[model samples]
Target: MPDSQIKFLVVDDIRENMVALEALLRRDGLQIDFAGSAAEALELMLVNDYALAFLDVQMPETDGYELAELMRGAERTRNIPIIFVTAADRDERRHFRGYEAGAVDYIFKPLDPVVLRSKAAVFFRIGQQARELECQRDEMRVLAHHRDIAISRLKAHADNSPLALIECDRNLTLRSWSKGAERMFGRSAEAMLGQRIAQSGWLDAEAAGILQTWVDGGTSAQRHSAEIDARRADGQTISCEVFGSTLCDLNDGNLSLSLQLLDVTERRRAEEVRSLLIGELNHRIKNTLANVQAIARQTLRQADSLAGFEQGFVGRLQALARTHSILSDMTWSSASLDQLIDEQIRAGTLDAARLLRKGPTVQLTPENALRLALSLHELGTNAAKYGALSVPGGEIRLTWTYNDELLVLRWEERGGPEVHPPARTGFGTTLIRASAGCEDDGVSVDWSASGVIWTITLSVGVAQPNQPDQERLIEPAKIESGRPELDGSRVLVIEDEPLVALDIRYELTAAGAGKVDIARSIGQALEAIRAAEIDVALLDGNLSGERVDEVANALRGRKIPFCFVSGYGRQHLPQGFQDAPIIEKPFRADALLPVIHELIRR
Candidate 1:
């Protein structure tokens, strides 16, 4: 109803007093109704709703108090606000009696017009608000009725649809089954109804238990979906996708579930085949790229002329091929560290009596196997050229120990020509130092007069007997100029090549990124992005064959600044990422550090 139609009732035996009261409460949106006596006021109240009532204290036969008592006794007028209008002097007892008669307030004789009108206006606005709330409740009831109709229509449709539909009670007993369900499961409703769904042989024990758990734990609003192997009446298993939801039975108000099943055995089989093929392809491509990189590095290092480059390149390729052969035998999972050292160092050596090796059994991951194989090759080549192996009487001892989560290797040479530090570090020296491990001061070389003694320390994650509980060793601190301290910033590196990933992690830590996370696949990268509190990210433009655009977009959406570290150039990137900085592959610390600092500052 419109606000303009609201009514106010006035009661008094004196006609003049009623007129004065009506005029006092007069307003544009108010409908004022007057009654000459208590009986007349009660009659009008029986048929109409009032925002408020003004009742005189004195009356002919039935006083205002008596009329109010009758109104209170009935449900219809009990909550109507009453204001007592009186000519009597202000007496405490009379006021108390007025309250007992359900007067919400009182107005004295010769009432102040301003006070009376203001108080009545307050009740009028409150009545309007109450009416609006009631209207809203009515609209909601209508919507609920329509929703019930829709559910009924859905039930009818399910009975005739091709997909199987079954309903079960709270205890998982079959309450209803459609014709589609009977055909799909090869059982009639008469045989299944009122029996536990598990007894019907439609679902195996494990599948049934999983469904039951969801039903018992889930609320009426939750809809759960699962793929399970279901058994039919003939004892044949088929993969099916089940959609289940909890609902209330309208007739009994008991909890029940509605389940729909669709066959998907063929689709699942096809997807598995496709996933296996893709995984194998990505593995082969990445391995081939790593081999090419290794060959290029060695070729450039040993090449003084075209002939020298060809000869060195072929030797390095053969060495890399041998390592790959061993890795392939192990399905590229891991290789024994001792086997790797022997294969790489003792390949073409005739005087093997000069070399001594000692170490416990340790397995190296495929990436580590390749890197260490190259480093050992470089060290052996140097020794053959200028160090111990070049002399017939020279001797070299390789001893290693694992303790406190640190793997320490000492390469000591004696009985050779006097040694001195090189004027400039060569690529072989750099590769050996990096592979052996260098954090602050992990790699050290003693250029004694007798020979060179190299001590290298690496942090190993796997635990062994007598090893320290800590998974990593504490690194010594180093202060480097032009490298800003990240002050414990969290960094995420998304690279698929394991060696490159390790390099990025090491550099990030050395530059003061307290936490460095590695993600080798797109799925793992996305998971890390969500789970970590990342301050900056170093993203590889591509992960295997998939581009890192999705990860970059997610970082952008979160306002996390990141730069791409890829082999590709700017034009090769996706359209929207042209402006994002791209740190080219074979990253240098000088180029990478500034970009990282700028990203964090921005």
Candidate 2:
């Protein structure tokens, strides 16, 4: 309303006088209202606010004098300034009457335009000043209201934030302690405010010194953050992360800081545990890899031929893998004895139907379980080849008994070919004996007339031997009744992994093969075949991830008698090599001997 037009009222019985006065007063931001009689002027005054009123002294019926009296009587219209419009020939009594009737001044009938404007401009200026003052008052009221709301919102944030919010001067005198801060230190705001920061006793002497130094450094927000062990009101020590910043209030000449702290005790503990687990994992991995490498070397040294070496070496690796799988399932703590026996027998491809096992539920530590698995696999394979399991009617009874101090496992055979002691100890015999790790009473094999009887005795809950000594790696007497026909046969081995290729070379050379050649990729294999005459070749089913059919075709064209060696079993054989004799990885020398002999005959 103050910003709208400034209006003024003019009351006159004659239209000419009113029109002339209205024109003089009318300008930008000013509105003039005209009325012919006292009744009309009173009505105009009641509905609108006017800056100035000019009334005629002489009028019909209800005159200007009566209107002035009426306006003065009413509360809404009393404050408006009124000037009388009169004739130039007015008597003194008429002038007195106008003055006494509440008219501030009089104007003549023959008006002076410049004089009229000057007088009316005074009242208009006063009205404008009053409106401006009122507007300024309203603006100040709004600004005060906003300031109160802002303070309330800031207080709410300080009370409800998850982090402890503390405000202090650079000298470390506390200024504000939020509800969050109170909860963290177990102290109330009233008790904390105005006190020195360390007075709350939340930190130890050393921790307090560190925090004081940091505050003195005048670091910006989040520029200085640290983890410190702090004490709570209950005297419990906890890890806390402190973050702070210097406030931008340099004009006050006193520096301040806003500090926030969060509890990180659980997170620190978790990190410590994770680091220990990583170290343990790394140590276990390195040890396991070394053990496997040694097994491969020992198996190769005693193998009589490539075929035998593949069989023995692969079987040992499989046994170790299966044992590790069970140990992993048990978190490497212990393993079930029944599970170890079942896995080793199945992996050796032995006839479980002809065997019976009777034992109470038994659990062995990880180390003992590994050794026992290797021994069981060897015994199973020997029975299938030459002892009880060779005949369908033969049966092997395995039984075990364990107590607090000792564990005894027995293997008995019946209804098979007559048994007799071998001429020399084989690798399997040495392995099972070493696994026993006993001098007086360990492992024994009785070549009884009915079948072979094997028994292993071990100390329960005692440390077994970690690994067999390399000096104990015996070169066994040949298993073949007659010397292998491959005596001096030149052989080519195609395998991708370097260690596996070297193992194959060792076995073939030991088996009386002459000048064994090795190739990794298909191109290298084909080139080797062209450079020399190869009597027989062992083809890897897969080179990297691809089928090695192209290299097989080259061998076929050369009329070389070769067999497929695949670790993935028959399902993964090279497409065109289906007609070739195939042997899976990890075969015993006996299994490979027949494959090589068959190829030689072909």
Candidate 3:
């Protein structure tokens, strides 16, 4: 029934009695139904709810007591309040029988309206309160269902999160481990729960100690953020950035640490790589600066005036710049040999008819390409000044060949002025020999009567640090007559970096050294020491990736004077040459030549 309606049922064998009671008890919000017989009342009771039922005690086929017995027996109608109505005197035995049949009270036939309304009002209020309670119970059930769904979603989100999430109790025992944590640490939740975090073998001893210190240094609610070195199950080192906060559980106000760990190992490694690349770039730049310095000095030496100096220096610088541009296009990796030749020809403005290029395909390493480009520029400068290019209808031929293990290149001038060796070796000849590596027979120049011919043999393939291309041909020039420091002296320049070696060779040649040999590796330096009488040597403390200690030891054994030319500190040099003369790189010819002069004098 509606909450605003209070229903009451009244039954009698006489219609007048029921009608009189309904008229007496009826009011707003109260609904009264009249039934003529006990059977009609029983049928009405089964289908509709009633706050109170009033039945006559005396009836033809059934009495109020009998109807009450039936309502008491039924589960659906048993709880309806019953009030027996009769037109007889009160008796103890009758009252007992009415009470036994589930009657709350009995009303006489000429009913009092005041007493009836008071009794009925109590039951009506009780029924309304029951309906209110039922509605509240249903609302509570819906709220509980919604709460369960929210908890399920929150749990799923935590478990599937990409960052590792872990919760631990006040005692540092793991209480919750998400699937993300499990995957990151390679440990299952079953194994981790109840395990003390610091002792769980997840963090290294030092990291665990640091964390413990953090916890003990502050209150339970303190937050922590730091990057820590962690370890996987396989014992490999990993880096993680940890963010931690102490959370108080709402239910019991219990404190626990919640941590989110982010993996940063790869990012850390990339930073290290960037640092190394920057260092290497700094080293290469230093080498280039040294080359420029060498060029300026040598150009000054050969120039007849300021104009000649500017022309020569700027041309060499531009050639260096052009070579760098070409290498930069390939990311400084390698350059095509023929492509380099063609570029140099175009840059030098060489006559296409007078010069022939015949070469198989070859790739030169970045350093080799640059060195050869500058060397070729020097050759062109000389040829234009005195060789084939100086005369009309003069001709030049260039060719190259490779035999898988070695590469050879040749430069020949067929028609020009009668070729003859100069009294003193020029910078061009010195650079060609210096950059050609220190191997014996690596480079040679033949001054034929007709013109000049140059041949360069380079070892290529696997063992070389980078691709091959070295050596050059130019005007024949022997050592210049000079002061006693280096007249007719034979020297060894043991260095790995080609550009630095080239500068050293130029300096040595200008100092009147008759022959300056170059060695780029340990074995090559050792072989050079054993192959010829090296009056003095310049030994790089480190050649390629190895210490050139063997070369130093050989020089010491031969009683040949040599100095350590390196960028390393004295402490980093090889064993037992502490007293040897040393010159750091980015060194000048003025600073370097005196040391060799002293070594030769000694």
Candidate 4:
């Protein structure tokens, strides 16, 4: 074979070995150089590039490892493939060390001529391919840089042009607007971008409605034009032809919306002046709606009682009012979900632990928030009147989270009067499921007489990620009945309910209590405990005559062990005393036995 392309370096203490390696590789079209030691190899490499280096493992002053490390440290020869020529057994540690020091492969001292030639040829082709790829990458980088510069220039020209250009995302948040938009909208470009066009005063109600008509399923990627009025930053309204189109980039496949404002002030002002009569017609229509509601309310009020009216007109009016209020608060744009929940549930007074409100923490755009709040208000009003929060012995907990892009909120009731699910769907239910003006499905309210649980999910664009728990607001764990076992100890029962007092006496007798006393009022209970040797007292909260908390204080003063029995919930109890034994009303006999025993056992 002609020695035309490949290059190789041979290093060894013996000149005869270099000659033999060079002769063997010459058959593969390789040019060979000789170095008698590592120092000579370093000198040759500094001046030229070699495809492969054959280093003798047993050099005198600096071995193959030392020489390979030197070549690897030099930038030019760092990646040159090294082959360690050695007679040492492959299992020897130093022979392995030679490979670790950057040797590509190992060759015994009596090198096989064919094996040497093949290895050198392998590295030469690899090096040539690597150089080619590096050149291609550099070219791609140059092309990308030029593309970015072209895009930047195009955007700058678009911004400086006279026509107002507005770009918005799917949710209608302005993503980009040009200098012309800033001038026409009476706002800075920086202030307008990322703001909703409606909020930035770029389009009036009529113009926005027309634009929305185009935005919803108009010919995809086609321009739409209509004449309407837009508002400027100075609060001055101008006549304009609003042009809108869906933008689909063919190369990148990104979907966007583009809106353009062509000032038709002189051409359209005459038309708008003539259309002032149309604005009056719209106002009349709104007045007609209010008049209809008023008439409905007046007709419903003719009934003898308010219940019929509440179901018919009042509920509808409240829903409408809530919607209006929410719209006003959001400036008719969007409402925050958290703010709506806070407003509707403001009346619930359960302890932080008992009342929990958790969710995605994203603000609902005005329309969704308004509809959801109206539904939740109905749920809230019903709970305030008859559900868990209505009675003293109840609790309501609300929590929500976003799972898989779906928003779900849950209301759980506990420690409440026996619940029976709502017998029939009422106005509250209808308002919840009403899909009148919202993109989301209607509210879902699950009403149990025990309490009302409601979940409202509306797609309000993209949902937010789950937030970490703000603070653990869970109810403290109930203190297990610390009541000692009665163990024949004297027990006192102070209760206002005659039947309940008699029942406690019966329970204590069954439990083998030595003595039992029942008191209907705090005064009587106080006297009985003072006069008797009472080991344990089962006190009833809400005595006919006094506060049960005061009775507890007196019992504690007397060093008497006492547990409370009441229909009241944790919410009704005074703060800082949740740990006390509180047996819920209508508890079973077996439950009472444990408390009686546990309290007196001590």
Candidate 5:
């Protein structure tokens, strides 16, 4: 007899009959689960995979007919075959009714154990065949997709007419050369086809030696690059950057090499002009920095005494430091508009109390965050010194909106002593606008007697979806002793943080884990999985700097179920890793218990 791995669900109101059927099926190497009612059976089906279900036709609430109908309604359990175990007489009406209720076959009591085993074997074989065919279809689909992408890339390269395309065999025999190659080297494919490239007239003595060394290796698998001057067919020398690398067959066993030759003379000449301009720009920046530093020193030195210097020089330096801090927060790039305003306004100060900030979340890339932060600093400083924030009962409102993909941020102030425009342009205005200049997008400001208003519109990248919170389900009014059965299975805990690892270990043990093993690293986790059978695992996304996906794959390879517990958002989770239960960081113990039991039963 062949060993069978098919699982069967045994549903019956009578516990004795269920046990008898289980005993009979055990001889055939079938794993079985016994359910007292159809509702219990359906709940089992939701989380477990069984080749067939032996459902009793008549039972308490939700008999086999109602149970089968519900199963058919659910996408996850619709495919499981149902075999009716009933005492219904052999009437055509009852037979038709059973078929309508999604039963594959109906059996009468007193049951024949031998006949029941034979019928189940047939459906089990069918399920295995269906699974195998699906796997094959998926493999073919992946192969076809890769082939299409390769063909598309090849067409793009061919149509663009790159500087030169060279194709050679294992022995350095020229097989194909493109038109661009002919124009660059003054040699046609018709003249070079089927000829040894070493015998070609292009290479000089030193180049020939290098080419021969590469050819002696059958084919140079790694890229070989060199800049060399070679005489064309007309005896005029041209400088080219030649690169060669091997290509392997996508399907069958075959190998070849392709070389590309690029003409870089024009680009090299342009680099010289760019270098001169860059040097002049650098010198101008240095000169400007020196002048600004001298002016700052002069302003402080001309003050009456130490107290004046502290009041003048120290304030400006602190403002500069605040701008620098905001820039650093953005990694020296753009900062979010709201974050800029919040950071520049001291919490206990009038600027903070009078400020009103409202906007959707927006992120500035490094350069923009810094510029926006500096501009925001100037606004906050001016308000503190003279505008709304400087007076009692003053107010400021900052609002932003996204209209048709444009990010518009507004800074409006009011409720201060009647405002007035500055008598003359000052360094504050220069620095504020200069910071905005870092962005290609234009920035505009309006200074009014009532208040100062500034608005800037810039492009912002779209945001990805946030991780979904746990689903809410209605629990049974009162759980009977047999209410929802928690799985009594082994669990593995893989977390590098010792505190987190111990917490998971304690919870699993309290949750009735028969055996719980803790692994702090990827290597240990794999070893634990291999040495002991695991029913479920709770893994951290970063275990010894390795992704939890690696642990997931190992569990999948063994047909074990596992869930991830990560501080990182679901977006950071590896692909194909989400469907399995994920408990986000700071999850409660109660939430994890249900998922563990669900996956375990699966």
Candidate 6:
């Protein structure tokens, strides 16, 4: 309520005295209630909250001291300030009695208006301050009520959440555990609370140390998150993503820790599987591209014209692509040898019905599948162009049998133009002979007057069941006379993917680069730049979500040339780096070597 609404009481038997008291206390915003007798004053005091009271000491029936005593006895009026007014002369004994009766001051009349007003003003201000204190107290109570409700709601939510919530003290002693924690850890709050986190044997030493550091630092605002292994009640280790933050205890204002743990065992396992698959994919892609490169080089070496080279290269790539598709459909594990032969024959011949094929159910590994598919494609192409399939009634009999774990396959042609062995070795011939193990006398070609008979006997080990064996046909080229030479030059490679980074390191090392340094992120790259004297740098455009601009700037400041290698386009590069050479991903040795040589020369 507004201060102006505050009321004061005045009691006296004489009308003149009551008027005098009211007038003396009168001021703007001052409310006065007049009562002539003690009984009447009691009634007014009961109904209205009075700031101060004036009682006449000599009233009939009940005197000022008696009325003051009555007001003091009541709960509501006990705290109200009282001043006694009397016409009789002041005596020490009467003053003591007045004070004993709860009178704050005794006034002897005829009263001095100045002294009375001064004392009344003092009481008025005191009453206003008291009311304000009461109002503030009420507001505090309301705010505290709301805070309690909010805390209760949060506790309810935390209890029901899937993430475990655990609160610990500075000593890493568990203080509170949510229901979610109990469910996640398979331990009850009663069992875990007040136990040292380390003693519980759930968190590993490293994880425990991390939590200890956070607690020791008293970093309430800073959040720390990490993936760690935590042992459950059943002693099974599970992967958990833990988020730690500091919280202040409302009761004691002491620093404590709140840890939220999310069980990510499945997620971590899935990520491991995905990473393995990605590594496998990278290896496969590298191998496939290398194969394509070899095919192009070999095809180009024997092509009579550019058109011939294009035709041969495209046909080889198509054959590789089709084989890849089939392997992909089978999850890259194994493919049916008979199915592979049929598909290749159908692709090359419109009269596929005329072709004879016989084979047992045989599954070929990815490596063997790809190589065998290419060989079969080459054979079919040859038959269609110059051998049996060139004539309408021509017949190509392909048969295979497995004995003593050896696969014997024969491609015999008949009823077509006379055939002769090629005058010069071609890519098709090389691929077929190499794949069939002709170097080991595993394959033979006999040119007869009727047709060409090519027979191959390979151990079943050549067609590995599920595992893709390393190719024996081609090996990655190393630094040679024609390749770019870095003999004594230092090179820095910045890439996040481990496999890609390793590949870059291998390539640089093979090119005779000395002291090749690899950094998986921008921070590491910057550190490497500071420590090493780099001649040239190959930086992935994105390093773990951070752009390599800072590293690039550092390299530029050092007058060291750097190139960007990324799966993204040049447009995705940071501004000012567009001028830098960008080699798109899946780059070959020929493409990468030239860039490196140019950068080193610059």
Q: Which candidate wins on TM-score?
A: 3
Candidate 1, residue 451: lDDT: 88
Leading candidate by lDDT: 6
| Model 2's TM-score against the true structure | 0.58
- The local distance difference test score of each candidate is 0.77, 0.78, 0.79, 0.68, 0.70, 0.81
Query: Candidate 6, which segments miss by more than 4 Å at Cα?
Result: 11-17, 27-30, 35-48, 52-126, 149-167, 178-188, 210-228, 234-282, 297-310, 328-331, 336-350, 353-363, 395-430, 433-602
lDDT of 3 by residue, 403-434 (tens): 76677878888779999998888777876765
Candidate 5's TM-score reads: 0.30
Cα lDDT tens digits, model 5, 1-602, are 23234567998999998988887677454568889987788888887778889888888887777888888888988888888888856788877877886788988888887898788778767767765676788898999999999988875676467678888776667888887888888888899889876687776767656655655554445777888776688988777788877666779645666778887766766887689768966874575366448537754556577665544443444444444455444444445555555545532122555666666666666545545655676677678778888888887787777656667778788987677777876655655665545464546778788888878766554221233222111221221122233446778888888887787777677767777778888899989988897788887878766676777788888888888887655666667866776665544455467778778666
Candidate 6, lDDT over the whole model: 0.81
Supply candidate 1's per-residue lDDT for 482: 79
Candidate 5 regions exceeding 4 Å error are 1-5, 27-29, 126-238, 241-256, 260-602
Evaluate residue 100 in candidate 3 and report its C-alpha lDDT on the 0 to 100 scale: 91
Give the TM-scores of the predictions, in the order they appear: 0.36, 0.58, 0.59, 0.37, 0.30, 0.56
The candidate 5 region of ten consecutive residues with least summed lDDT is 471-480
Model 1 clashing residue pairs (backbone): none
Candidate 2 lDDT, tens digit per residue, 1-602? Answer: 34467888989889998888888888888888889888988899899988889998778898788888899999999888889988764788877877776777788868888888888888889878777777788898898899889989988987888788888887778898889877877878897788876776766777667667766776444466778887777788878898877765758666777788887888898888889878988987787778778777877888889878877777877787778777877778888777787776555444566767776666788778888888888887888888888887997788877656577889898888999899888778877886666555688778889888888887864332333212111122222344365778888999998887887787677777877899889889999988888888988888887778788889988899888877654556656566787665655555566577668767
If both were scored by TM-score, which would come out higher, candidate 4 or candidate 6?
Answer: 6
- Candidate 4 residues 295-411, lDDT tens each? 365536453466555443544444445455555555555665555554443322233445666555665655456456556666656565666667765666777766666666676
Q: After superposition, how far is residue 66 of candidate 4 from its true place, in Å?
A: 2.6
- What does candidate 6's lDDT look like per residue over 1-602, in tens digits? 35446688999999998888887888876789999899999998888888899888898999888999999899988988888988874788988998998988988898899999999888888877877888999999999999999999999999899999998998899988889988888889998888898888878788999988887777645898888888889998888999999877779878888899999999989999999999999999899889989999999999999978876776777677767767767888788776576556534432456577666666777777787788887887888889888888898888877766788779899998988777887889878776654347877889887998888777754442443322111122232226788777898888899998788788788888887888997788888888888889998989878877788899888888989988665657777866588766655555577788888988
Worst 10 residues of 1 by lDDT: 470-479
Per-residue lDDT, model 5, residue 1, is 24
Give per-model CA RMSD: 23.7, 11.7, 20.4, 27.1, 32.4, 14.0
